[model samples]
Target: MKLDDIKPDIVHDVTGTYCPVPIAETAKQIKEMEIGQILELIADDPGVVEDIPAWCSSTGQEFLGMYEEDGEYHLFVKKVKELT
Candidate 1:
C-alpha cells in the first residue's frame, strides 16, 4: 500500500521535540500497539529522517516511509512484532 494511503492506528506528535525524544516516544508507543498496527509519528526534528528508519531496523519493525510538509515530518511505522 502507498504511504499516503496507509491509515495509522495511532499518532504521536512530537513537533517541538528533538532527537531521542521522537525515537523514545515511538518506542514507548509501539510497545503498546498490536502487530500490524501503523504508527504515524509527527515530528519537526530533522534527525528523525535518519533516526526513525534506523530505529525501526534495529527494533525489527517496518519503516513504511515518511513525508515532509510545512517544515514538519510525518513518518509511518508498522508494528511487526512484540516488544518486551
Candidate 2:
C-alpha cells in the first residue's frame, strides 16, 4: 500500500516537541494501541528521522515508513508485538 494511502488508527501530533519527547510520546501512545493498529506520528523534531525506526527495531514493532511534508515529519508505525 502507498504510504500516502495509509489510514492510521491513531494520530498524535507533537509539533513543537523535541528529541526524546517525540520518542517518549510515541512509546507511550503505542503501548495503548492494539496489535496490528497503525500510528501516525506528526512531529517537527528531526530526531524522529532516526529515533522512530530505531525504536521500532529494538522493540520488535514494525516501522512502515515516513515522509516529510511542509517542514513536518509524518511517521507510520504498526504495532506488531504486545508490550510487556
Candidate 3:
C-alpha cells in the first residue's frame, strides 16, 4: 500500500540526500501534523540513521519504526506532542 494509505499525520520527502536540510524539512512537516498522528518519511540518506531517531527522542515524538523498500528508507514517527 502507498505510505499515504497509512493516512499518516504527515509526509516528508527526505529522498535525494539525507542532509540537514531534508531532515529539517521532514521535521517541519511532522511538526505541522496533528498530535498523536503518524508521519511517514521517505529518505535515502545514511545520516537518517542518526538524524531521524535523534530528532524523535530529542523532541519526545514516538519513533514507531522504519523499513527499507527498493532504494529508499521509510520511517514512521508518531507525534506525541507539539513542537516547541
Candidate 4:
C-alpha cells in the first residue's frame, strides 16, 4: 500500500514547537505504540522535514513519507522496533 494510504494510529501536532520538540514528542509517542503502529506528526518546523526521517533511520523506525498542506508538514512514521 502507498504511504499516504496508511491510516495513522496517532496524530501529533507540534506546529509551534521547534527543533528537538517535534522529534522528541515523536519519540515519546512511538515508544508507547505497538510495533507496526503508525504515527502522523503534524509540524510547521522546517527542521522536522529532515530531522524526522533521520531520527527514524537512526532509531530503526520506518519513515514512510511526508506531505505539506497549508504550510504545515505531515510526516508519516511507523514503529518498527520493539521497546525494551
lDDT of each: 0.95, 0.95, 0.79, 0.92
Better of 2 and 4 by lDDT: 2
RMSD of each: 0.7, 0.8, 3.2, 1.2
Candidate 1 on 1-84: residue-level lDDT in tens?
A: 788699999999999998789999999999999999999999999999999999999989999999999999999999999876
Candidate order by TM-score, highest to lowest?
Answer: 1, 2, 4, 3
Per-residue lDDT of candidate 2, residues 14-62 (tens digit): 9999988999999999999999999999999998999999999999999
Predicted structure 4: lDDT: 0.92
**Which has the higher TM-score value, candidate number 2 or candidate number 3?**
2
Residue 84's lDDT in candidate 4: 45
Please give the range of 10 consecutive residues that has the lowest summed lDDT in model 4: 1-10
Backbone steric clashes in candidate 3, count = 0
Residue range 1-84, candidate 4, lDDT tens digits = 686588999999999999889988999999999999999999999899899999999899999999899999999999999644
Model 1 clashes, total count: 0
Query: Candidate 3's residue-wise lDDT over 34-70, tens digit each?
Result: 8878888888886786788888999889877777888
TM-score preference between candidates 1 and 4, better one = 1
Instruction: Give candidate 3's TM-score.
Output: 0.82
Error of 4 at 54 (Å): 0.3
Q: Model 1, stretches more than 4 Å misplaced? A: none
Highest TM-score model number: 1
Off by over 4 Å in 3: 1-7
Candidate 2 lDDT score at position 26: 92
